[model samples]
Target: MARLFTGVVIYSFFVFLIMTPLKAKPSDKSKTKQNKYGIALIIGNKNYKDGVPPVDYAHNDAAAFKRYVIDILKFRERNIIYLRDATKANLDSALGTHNNVEGEVQSFVREGKSDVIIYYSGHGVPGVKSKRGLLLPTDATSNNAELVGYPIDQLYKNLSKIGAKSVTVFLEACFSGGSEGGMLIKNASPVFTRIEAPKSNLGITILSATSKAQLASWDNNAKHGMFTNYLLQGLYGAADQGEEGNKDGKVSLLEIKEWLNEEMTYNVKRQHKRRQIATVIGEENLILASVSPGRQFKPIQAFEKKKTVARAQRGAYQTPTISPSARASLNIHESYKSYGILPIKLKGKRCVPCENILIASLEGLPDAKILRGANARKADVVVSSFLSRLNVTQEANDAYASAKVMSGMFGAVLGKNIVDHIDRSTPPSFNIFDVELMLTAKDKNLGVSETARGIYFDRKDARQPKQSNTVKGINSVFRQAAERLAVRLMGGTPPPIKSAAQIRKQWEDKDQNAQNGNWSEDNND
Candidate 1:
């Protein structure tokens, strides 16, 4: 008995020793480096001037990133500069004047011994004249961004003067002069803003939410910018654990970008029915953060669960109500697979262009198919619309006209908008259109029907009195109405329809190229 017990104890001890990891317990993968010589400038600008739409959840985004910087990245709270709804003066005070790059940030740097991080969640506009990408400060206007806006190149130049060992920049704004659901600049003749992409210098690395011509999205459920939400998720260890990552614990700059590329592409496509690709410049092996409890990352599963909820929200699309007359047609799925979009009736008149725009809006439903101008009997579903109201009012843009106002009578008397052509201090005005419509969807095979009412507005710059934006505005209304009806009948809400300017640009391109250009959506990217 004594020999048996001693042999069992010796064998168990040997097995335990062999099974243990040789590297280190409480493994280094869960450990992050202490960045003592790093300084961060985090700014979230949401409430801009009245004309500009607020960047919803920008403050939340900034707050979350600031927390990660201090807690996860091991940055000291004292080394961080946090700003919300920052103004031009605030920018100048923190990063120094454009003329001389010397501010609180400059004072913190240790002359080639520090790493600098800059993150901005706000609006970015391009110079109407220079076409330079400019950060739209709270006190700035997109139409006159060149003067009041902070230049991106100037920002890089100022940071370069600090002489940090390396600088990393994260921009949660797009410079396309288009807001999440509207236009930022009111331009005459539906001109393309053509804002250039935000760029960085050799020593500076930049990760922007959207490329030029793309609009950044808001994740209303997360209460954060879609880009910023995933950004924090990556910093929270998901990036270190992704398949592209080595799972060695440290999350590198390259690893996070790779993770963002895959996740952002997939989520934006599924959620918004649009393409929003994060633009990354410069590939460095610099470690951004580290995972904890080494290789025990659970964020992947959590986020996947959230995605599944989104998928469920976009539930199996079926007719909301069915008639008793067609008993056999009441079955779902097979009965309403395609909808024939009839020409929308505008104030009791047929408008083919309005129908075309409405048809374009439903083009994104992945499960259901759209049949343009198909007969009601031929299609499984019949879609139609009636425009109830189309109203327009001309008004001055407060952001631009507040500087100095000239009577529209001057242009009215001169037979043209002389103020616009003369480049006078008296700014040009805009046209605001309010459109209301009732959209109807009839599941023909199911003998069911549903109706949705939608009201949308479009603002167009009236710089040239000769050019009328009525057609574009009406088209925009029909499109928005279609989006609303699509959600009511098809379960998932689509992205905001294109602005009047974008629709006009398409028409102009079609005319100029004689339909041979084959304009593609990716061109805007």
Candidate 2:
């Protein structure tokens, strides 16, 4: 399937109000509904005893996210929790205690009985040097140099106990070098992880505000964490407005990343005159809650099934065929139709090919179910064996010459016309394999002719049988990136475009203007 890069809803509002039960009336289902509550926990710890004040913003960020959740997202006040550096009693009532935040989280989840999202903004230090990631709540203190924060494991365990299916966590803090050395943790930067939810098909998604080595900046203009500011912007409609799959009201994790990249890059530059990096980790297909005003179900089954089949077939190098019994068992239509992973023949081998490769790669990394096939069973293994034999005589000769390796992969799958303007006929050193495309005036009408040229793999030499593996790895990356591009561009049906005649007229006008030097000059004077 096309890799999605947009989330579906505003983080402040995780649930859409639909069919609320009567206030006084009571029914058996009402009990279940009461338990099915959605909760958002936002904390900004801006004050610290000995630590840096700028390192924490737990109060401001939490307040903003709370307002968004309630006012904008329409969540009830009782359903959400906001915490600052409150007393132990208030902390216990709101979240949990110093030693048992996990228990509180679990109990809240179980009692609430629904999806929960936790947002933490504060100073994050490596937890004892061995843990994956940790979230420091507002009450965190580091008196003895040993880092103390809410252990992520306990949070996961509590979420599991509560029978919640989906939980999203956002961490905006620095984790690289703490004043006091301790366990190295992964949560210092932006990170996302999806874990199995209890009693349901729900999952957890984690979004970190920065990379492990990068710092989450403060915005004097926004008076909020740079990452959080851009994040909120990405949420609450800016991203959804520009995204394709947002039609369903839910934004996928991939869409969120793309929107964040675009928004943060510009917003941060203008706001702080610097660039910040955020990392998104988790299930690619994980659905963020809907932001649409009404209850609208945009079932992804049709789209998901098609991409799954395509990915499976692409890996196996064979046509995907589902038996009637298996389809029935899986509760899927026997004759399923998908708009992704169109069937194609490569090297006389029947296989499914994604419309985009980068998306395929991103999706493939998370899904262990997709397996490699027999077509790549044999190849040379030497590091330079297969590469030395392939015909890579041309240097950066295609539209992808300037693109990042991942982007180049997308260009390859999109048939190249999307980026034909990039000319890479010559290059000094091609750090990564790139394809160059040359277009004729007549061919320009057909769009870009996408091609891949490079010695990605070779088995001609007896020493290296892993040649096929190298090629497969590279192709896999390309395929995944391509899928991401497709998801971004085709999330929704595209607008209609002009006919060839219109295109010719437009082209002719531009050509005539160019010949006469009729375009406006940069210097107005």
Candidate 3:
């Protein structure tokens, strides 16, 4: 699948309403409807300690998310644990200590009876010593993070052991040192930190605010985090809107990821003018929310380790994996009928071969016609790809500072020329200009769109690969990126590129099957 950056929702009296659901009377302690089965731990930390940056409108974001939880997802209000500007003690009580997981937020799960939702909108800072990501509490200063701040990894661990049927976490805080909310760390500057997909337990999914090289942005006009607002909007029926969505009235995990990357990314690009994509972990194709009121999630057999797997299989292009029977409850998007490949550009220079390489890469993209020449303008969707130079020297140097923070003597070692002096360092040397691929697909005629981007050093380790800073290396990156983007643009998972010999073998097998009269239904030959 294409690596995407994006997620969000919004509601108001005058806002556009998609579909109104008939609410059921609440039997629980609170006045919320008895629809969704879950407990939610919502923390919107806005006011930070003195000198720390406040997450502007974070309290508003949490409040809005709560509204959706009740009004849309229909979770009873009594089951929710809401905290505004939560303190270190509050977070510890709610999420448990790093050493032991006894917090009500995780322990509140009723085994098979309740799913879990965790939403946090605050400042996340990296540990000065360990360099791990931490959610700074209102009372916790960025410098003393390891002592008072909440470890994001531990948060995952706590949530994973909840024994709930599923755990869905929505985080509006950016862990890479900055946010529209405020500067999280005291003297720390923002550096690109690739947030890894947590090793979540079965049925756990996490949708967070920003990609590796982005800061969490806010909608000043909306007085909400842009991610939080858009996510609310999506859950409120924008995700399941018309053809972009399945229109099934239920928003699935896949639908949410897709919708956010498309709608939120475009909106951010249009509004913030900087990249901020939502990153998701886990592939459980579960329904996240619904337009229909009081709809319940049907019981699926308990999540067994032996039963779950993720595959980018669609139509006839099934990946080489387990079996055909494994792919049930498939959330398939619409197959593109026609597409146009606009000229591929690198630093504003046209690269004809790059476009040709991309066109050739799309050979396995099923059920799509490539619009040719002038007719390309008439394509159902037009694809545009651009590659640009990215300088990471400053970011690299900041990482060295983080290295210094990790250990005092070690910090002294990674001094002014630390970016160059470190041997096998976590922060890579800034010898070469990194590349960023911005891939956009727009169906302007149909008011549909998607944006996906990948950076050369966009990884947790930030290790330099054998691919060097040369034309060949750039082309290599472009080829793979182009394929991934094209597949995603066409609404399919990127399949392994078929070799020329593999293609020949396929034809030879077809010929043999025809001669022997051994045609199979699946072959469709």
Query: Which candidate comes out best when scored by lDDT?
Result: 1
lDDT by residue (tens digit), candidate 2, 492-512? 111232333554466456534
lDDT of 2: 0.43
Candidate RMSDs in order: 30.2, 26.3, 30.1
> Where does model 1 exceed 4 Å of error?
1-29, 188-201, 294-525
Worst 10 residues of 1 by lDDT: 304-313
Candidate 1 residue-wise lDDT, 230-259, digit = tens? 877786778878788887877788888888
Q: What is the C-alpha lDDT of each candidate?
A: 0.64, 0.43, 0.62
- Candidate 3 per-residue C-alpha lDDT over 117-213 given as tens digits, one digit per residue, 9 for 90 to 100: 8999988776667767778889876667668878877888877776787788898977777666455666656654556678644456889988775
- The predicted structure with the larger TM-score, 1 or 3, is 1
Candidate 2 error regions (>4 Å): 1-36, 54-57, 86-102, 110-113, 128-132, 137-147, 178-202, 243-249, 269-275, 292-525
